[model samples]
Target chain A: MESHSGIAAVVKKTLNRRYRAERRFRRIGLAAVAVGLLFLAVLFTAIVSKGYTAFQQTHVLLDVYVDPDVVHVGNLDSADYQGLIKASLRELFPDVKGHRDKRNLYKLVSSGAGSILRQKVLEDTSLIGRRIQIWVPADDDVDMVIKGHVDRSLPESQRRLNNKSLAWVDALKEQGRLEKRWNLTFFTAGDSREPELAGIWGATVGSFYTLLITLSLSFPLGTAAAVYLEEFAPRNRWTDLLEVNINNLAAVPSIVFGLLGLAVFLNFFGLPRSSPLVGGLVLTLMTLPTIIIAGRAALQSVPPSIRDAALAVGASKMQAVFHHVLPLALPGMLTGTIIGMARALGETAPLLMVGMVAFIVDIPRGFTDAATALPVQIFLWADSPERAFVEKTSAAIMVLLGFLILMNGAAVFLRNRYERRW
Target chain B: MTTVGEIRAANPRMTCRQVNVYYGDKHAIKNVSIDIGRNEVLAMIGPSGCGKSTFLRCLNRMNDTIEGCRVTGTITLDGQDIYDPDLDVVLLRAQVGMVFQKPNPFPKSIYDNIAYGPKIHGLARTRSELDQIVETSLQKAGLWDEVKDRLKHPGTGLSGGQQQRLCIARAIAVSPEVILMDEPCSALDPIATARIEDLIHELREQYTIVIVTHSMQQAARVSQRTAFFHMGDLIEVGPTDRIFTRPRHSLTEDYITGRFG
Candidate 1:
């Protein structure tokens, strides 16, 4: 009786400590989860807050007389649209007299404003003699002033917009002629020195073409390699070495692939520089190991009994794989391929080495065209010595994140749709 | 040591002589010999890992799928050597079907599971012919009435007994002359086991079946002849009635009388 009571007393004492330890462990796990969620929330808030403004832009509505002589060049493409824009600005603010003042007055309109006027004239020849009112993009400096990014209390020398330009903007705003409109140019145009004219469309198209090439080349090759290794290859030292090398390739730095592309695709084969074709070839090399690894894992996940059943039913080895096992494993392979493509979509360092870092101004029309991917565009915008490019960089990041989410969502959907139980 | 009792069938469908099996360096089966008579059920009973299942797998060469497993010596099916180099293993398997220990229904509809074998062998030319083959195979396995209304449902959705019967029906659809069953009732309840035993009695009219079982009573109930193995050696072979009633090897008597396994 004495020994039993002593044992009971010891158990009673340690039970409370065990319970308390479990509670403490649970609390630590909860804290870890909470910290992860907090960081994610902070990242989203930072990107959305800085990038939402890029979706809207400031515009100035002005009435301009398209004088026939200024726009009536022998070739419509060579028409002097700049003169028409300058004459219209002079009409709006007639008090500006000196050459410097006149130049400053002309600075309120975007330098690309000539293209808009020239486009309108080319579309409608009847507008040559008519005074038409149009909403044109404001210059980046004027846009900054209107958006309140430039401090109005700052001296003339300290601010991007001087008092003279500020007065014109205030006058326009008071008359309800300066308004914030949807930034359609930000989605429709290409890279430009002027922030207001720069858009993500060109880079988006480049990314599309690059990924198209990557998928076409990598998916079939990766799946075939995976099937051969998993299903058909004999277990020997050679195959073991091959497997280890494939795993090692997946961990290799992506820039190494870019250098290989530079040396092989560009220099040896004389493929065009800065083309989506070359960038895609480099990305394919970078993503092949990832797809092959994922594909093999998927093939391995299939139950061995399925293979036995097929073979017992008199199926040849190839027929068994192609008929039953492949169908069951296909959904997994597709998920892996999409994940690899997403990684390739966001890859930057490899593209930079292959000359896809050029400031391309046209949307890529083909695989061989000079192009810049979305991540490269973000890198270039982030490095610019301008205040507006900061918002543009954030907006580009948002687009990239949206694509990644969409691809991952697709992977989940496919997995759930076709994954078999037994 | 030689096996006791008769190892020859009056009319044999498959004959094995001096067969040896190895897994890398481990000798799993040694000089085992048996004969499977046509239109009969032959039951092999033994303790776990006594090479009974290994010998049954050798009938259809199912052991070929296992890594490092090797089989030597001659095994003939209807007087033709099955291990010849030029023999088409696919055709051999088509002629000799199999049912696994567990009910492994392909993750497909019941109809497709039945139709898969016939379709692969091109046994049916028209769609209606294919449908007929599926219906007849299921009916022969005695699973038609229970699943006729839901032939399109997944085979995995069936009960354990129903799934096992569907596997039998899948094997039957191939129209093989011989069927190798590896512990067909080991994973089933008693009622399901009774159903499979009844199906085996009916199937013995048209197919030669060699079953690997653990229950001696089940062997006495369903099989016409019995083979007892111990430590990778065939200890006794005789009629099921005689093997259960008459005195033979001490190991066989000890195992049947519940003295030891």
Candidate 2:
């Protein structure tokens, strides 16, 4: 009886220990999941908060008399309109109690605002005859103050704009002279010297064209190569070597493809500098390895029995692959393609090597035209010394992240929709 | 009980003359010679790794898909050398189709699965003609009445036995003169296995059939001639009743009476 009781006690102790261990494991697993979720939440919150301020901008509204005499000067050469706009802006705020220095007053308007007004005048010469009230984008300091990026309590040495400028800005706000338009120009305009006026529309267009080129080139080439390798090619030493190279290519760093593109496309062939065509070519090389690897895996997932069934019916190997195997592998292939394209979309290093880092203010007209991608624009903005550019950089990053999430979501959706169980 | 010589005299559709198969350094098939008559069923029975299935794959050059597997000596169909390098493998396969151990229907509609072979070989030029071929193939496989109403459904959605019958229809759709089955009922339950056995008997009337079966009773019930393979060698080939009742090779006799594999 004593021995049996001792044995029963040990068994109960062991069972209790096992239960405790299981509970500990469950707690640790839940904790890990919570940690992962918290990390993602923090990253999203940080990005949205820092980036949201970029969309709103400050502007100075002025009803300036065109003064046909000043604009025309000696003749309507369209050149005099630029000086007239600058003179009008100076006259509008003459009696304002801001920094009385002429140079500081010039700082309130963006460095490139004169050129923007001149371009508008050049596009339409009839505007020279009328007195138009225009709301031009204010400089970065005024923009920061309106967006709450500026602190009025900071000393003049530490502050980006002085107290005198702040007083003038407050007076303008009180009189309803200062305005905050919907920033339609921020959507329509391209990159600018002032972060307050810079926009992503140009880079967005560039990304669109670059992806168009990448998709057009990579899909057919990658799928065809995969089909030939997986189906038609005989099992021989040369084909084996080819397969090894293809696998190795998939593992190679994407930046290496950029260097290769720099050497071959830009140097050897002399393609247009900083063009989406070159960026597309570089991205294609980077994406090819991914697409081919994915395509081959998709192709291999198709059972050999399907091929046999097709051939048993007198279908040739080509027919078997195209009609049967290709269809089955398509979902996987498309998922791979979308994933590869998303990778290309986020890539900045390769584009930098191919000169896509150049500042391109005009939107890309075609694949051959010079262009700057979103990430490259972000990089450029981040490197600027202007404090306002920091927010703009974060905003661009937000847009890029949004695109990546959308593309990956599409990949997951396609996988679930077309994935075959067999 | 008839001897191999007697079966050959009856009607030889496919004659294998001392065929050997090698996988790299391994001799997978020894000098195994047999004759399969037209419109008859021949079952090759053996323990696992005895080359019964390998021999069946050789009938249609299905073994070619396996790397390092080499076939030697002559296999003839109607006195024509099948191993000739110039012989078109696709056409050879069309002449001698195969049904795998597991049901491997194409991920397509049941009608498309049956129509695929005929469509690829240009057996049907029009939609109506292809439909006729699909119907006849299904009818031949004994699946017409059950599936005719839902022919557009995916072939993979069927039960295991139905999928196997669909594979049989897919093979027959090509109108091959010979059909090789490799353990075609191994994955099915007893009822499905019995249904497949019945289909095999019905199929023998139109094409020469060679089946690899693990079940001795299935062999005895379906085959007219049974070839027993031991260690990759054809130990005996004679009437099924003779191989089961009378002893020729000691190994064949031992295998039949369950002395040892």
Candidate 3:
């Protein structure tokens, strides 16, 4: 009786210990999940806090009266407007009497604002005699001060903008001369040398054209290759070799594709450098592997019985694929395509290797024209010495993130809508 | 049991001449020969791995899709060689449709599922014409009255029996000459199975039907001729009544009497 009681106690202890261990494991799993959620929350908060200030920008409202005599020179040629604007600005603040103050005021406005004014004058010759209220971009230091990047207590010698300039900015703000608009131009304007004036509009257009080219080329080619390889091609060494190469291509880094594009598109084919067309061809090579992999997976997920049923109904092999398999695989294929496009949009290394890093100041007129992408613009701004470029870089990053989120959201929507069950 | 020579006298639509099938090194079907006549329901019944389904798939060359599966010997339909290289597989499948063991209705509307084959084959030119094809096919599958109101609904949304009927309708939409059924009722409940068995009887009027069934009772109830396979060989095939009551081969006799699988 004593031995039997001892044995029962051991069994009870073992069972209790086992149950406790299981509970401990479950608690650890729950803790891990909670930690993951906390990490995501922290990341989101950081991105929002650092990136929110990028969307708003400060502009100096200048009421510069266009001097008719200077602007409308002998014959009033639109091309001479730039020189007239510079002459008028020089007359407004004579460099002799207020040389230092005038230079400080000039520094507050972006150096490229004169060029912008000139372009506007060229477009409309009648503005020479008019008193127009133009909102010129403020210099990077002034932009930083408005964004609270510069502390007021900093010494004049150490600060980018001195006390005198800061005083002038304060006066302008009090007089409602410095205003913050919605920054609509940031979304509509093109890339620029002046960080205060740079926008993602040009890069967005480039990305659009590139994605169009990728979709047009990759969709049909990828699907056809997948269908042939999955359904029609005989299982042999040759097909095996093809499958291996496809998998390897998917693993190859995007930069290699850039180099390949440089060699083939730029060197061999002599395509225009820095064109969206070349960028798109490079992106197509980068995206094809993903599309093919996804297409094959989608096609393979379809049950063999469906094919059997189609064949049984007297449908040919081609009929079975087109009539049954292709339609079913479309949703998954679309999700993959969207994912591939998102990856292409965020790709900077490949574009950098190709001539996307080139300084493109105008909006791309066509696929064959020079273009810039959002990430490339961010990289360019982040490298600039202007303090205003810091905000612009963050803003460009936000735009890039928004596009990525949109693409991924589309993928999720398509997946949820058309995902099928046997 | 009557020999293949005697069975040939009945004007068979399909004749398998000593057909053999191999999957890589394994002999799946050995010297199996059978004759199927028009409007006749022929049931091939045996235990698992007995080459019953293999022989049924051979009828439609569905085996062609499987890797490493090779068929030797001739299978002819109405005296036309089925394995000829020049034969269009699509046309052949259109003539000989199949319903799988598990109902595989395309993920499409009930109307569209039936319309798919007819549309692909250019069997119907206009919407009204396609609608007529869908209606006739569903009617033939014995599901038209029950589902006619919800024809626009997904075929996959149907119950098991209804989905199976939808697949049958999809098969019949192209107006195939022969319908091959591979364990079509195995995944269903007894009630669903009974409905499918009834539908099979109804389909025989328009199609030459061949079915692979695991249930002995189903074979007795629905088939006019029955083929019993054992160990990748056609052990015996004869009239349903004779094969069930007095199978000549010992293997067939043992299988029927439950002596062994």
Give the best candidate by TM-score. 1
Which candidate gets the maximum DockQ versus the true structure?
Answer: 1
Write down the RMSD of all candidates, one decimal each.
1.8, 3.2, 3.5
Mark the regions of model 2 whose C-alpha exceeds 4 Å error after superposition: A1-22, A71-103, A111-132, A236-241, B1-9
Q: What is the DockQ of candidate 2?
A: 0.69
TM-score of chain B of 3: 0.96
- Per-prediction interface RMSD? 0.8, 1.6, 1.6
Q: Write the per-residue lDDT of candidate 2 for residues A1-422, one digit (tens) a residue.
A: 56988999999999999999999999999999999999999998897898877777777766655666766535545455445555665676676444455556666766656666666666666777687776677888888887887777877999877876677678668877777667666667688876776899899888888888899999999999998988888889999999899889877887888899899999999998788999999998888878998999999999998887776666777888999999999999999999999998988888898898988889889999899898888889999998888888888899899999999999999999999976
Query: Higher DockQ: candidate 1 or 2?
Result: 1
Clashes of each: 0, 1, 8
Q: What are the per-model DockQ values?
A: 0.78, 0.69, 0.65
Could you give candidate 3's per-residue lDDT for residues B1-261 as a string of tens digits? 223313452878899888999999999998877789989999898889999998888888888888999999988888998999988777788888888899988777899889888877899889999989999999988899999999999888999999998999999899988999999999999999999999899888889999999998999999999888888877778889998898877888888988886
lDDT of each prediction vs. the true structure? 0.91, 0.84, 0.84
Chain A TM-score for each of the predictions: 0.96, 0.88, 0.88
Least lDDT summed over 10 consecutive residues: which range in candidate 1 chain A?
A67-76
Give the local distance difference test score of model 3.
Answer: 0.84
How is the predicted docking of candidate 1 categorized under the CAPRI scheme?
medium
lDDT, candidate 1, A1-422, per-residue tens: 56988999999899999999999999999999999999999999999999988888888887888887776746578877877788888888888899988988888988888888889888988887889988888898888777778878877898877788888889888988888899999888879889999999999999999999999999999999999999999888999999999999999999999999999999999999999999999999999999999999999998988888889989888988988888889999999999999999999999999999999999889999999999999999999988888888999899999999999999999999987765
lDDT of 1 by residue, B99-197 (tens): 998998989999999999899899999999999999999999999999999999999999998999999999999999998888898899999999999
Which scores greater on TM-score, model 1 or model 2?
Answer: 1
Q: Categorize the docking of model 3.
A: medium
For residues A1-422, what per-residue lDDT tens digits would candidate 3 score against the true structure?
Answer: 56988999999999999999999999999999999999989877776777667676688777666667767745555444444444444444454246677676678877766767776777787887887777777786888888889988977898988887888789778878787666666788788776667788998998888778878888888888888988999999999998999999999999999999999999999998988888888998998889999999999999887777666666678888998888888899999989988998898888887798888888998999899888888888889887766767777888899899999999999999998866
Interface RMSD of 1: 0.8
